[model samples]
Target: MIEIGHTPAKRLVTIRVSGKLTSKEYDTAVPEIEQAIEQSDGKLNAVVELDDMRGWDIAALWKDLKFDARHFDDFRRIAVVGASGGEKLSSKAAGALTSADVEFFLRDQVDKAEDWAAAD
Candidate 1:
């Protein structure tokens, strides 16, 4: 499952992922994000929290890649909060794929991640 929250200012978006992610969830989540970016005229930040998320299905992974490629320059900062080493590694890999300044926070530092993502 995936949950998304956005500020009224539309400058920052928060995404939480739990359990297994499927294309269905991405279909629901991605459009809101894209709309947020459009409303912001391209300046946006993201904080993604991976909570007990096992992984993505193949179709979901494809959607992820496509979204990343399409919005490679859309985000100003991206903070990924997770509890596992693999998640940290995935954060680094994501940094390499986009222009955003990407950072990884331990699950305990989610507050810090939110602060960073919301910073000017």
Candidate 2:
């Protein structure tokens, strides 16, 4: 399951994933991110925090691929926080989603990640 939380002023969005993530859960994630993108006028900042998050369903991977293929520029920066091997794998999966212009940072350094995400 994925739980989405938005910061005030619509400047930042955080996605928390717990348990196995299926395509359905992934599908549910889009609207929140899309809304955050819209609020940020296309160049949005986001944090994908994975705590107690398990592996992803095959369909979720497909959904992620499609999402990246279509809305590649919506994200300005993506910070992934994970502690487990599955989280590491999940973070790597985002490589395909990143573009030359997009900044992708691992979630290890919280302060640095926040500073990077907050950059104009």
The prediction achieving the highest lDDT against the true structure is: 1
Residue 86 lDDT, candidate 1, scale 0-100? 95
Question: Residue-wise lDDT of candidate 2 within 24-111, one digit each (tens)?
Answer: 8888788877777677755677677766776788999788788788778676677776666666666676766765133444556655
- TM-scores of the models, in the order given: 0.95, 0.76
Tens digits of per-residue lDDT for model 1, 1-120: 999888847388999999999999999999998988887745799999999999999999999999989988989999999999999999999998799999999999998998998888
**Most TM-score-accurate candidate:** 1
Off by over 4 Å in 1: none
Residue 22, candidate 2: Cα error in Å is: 1.7
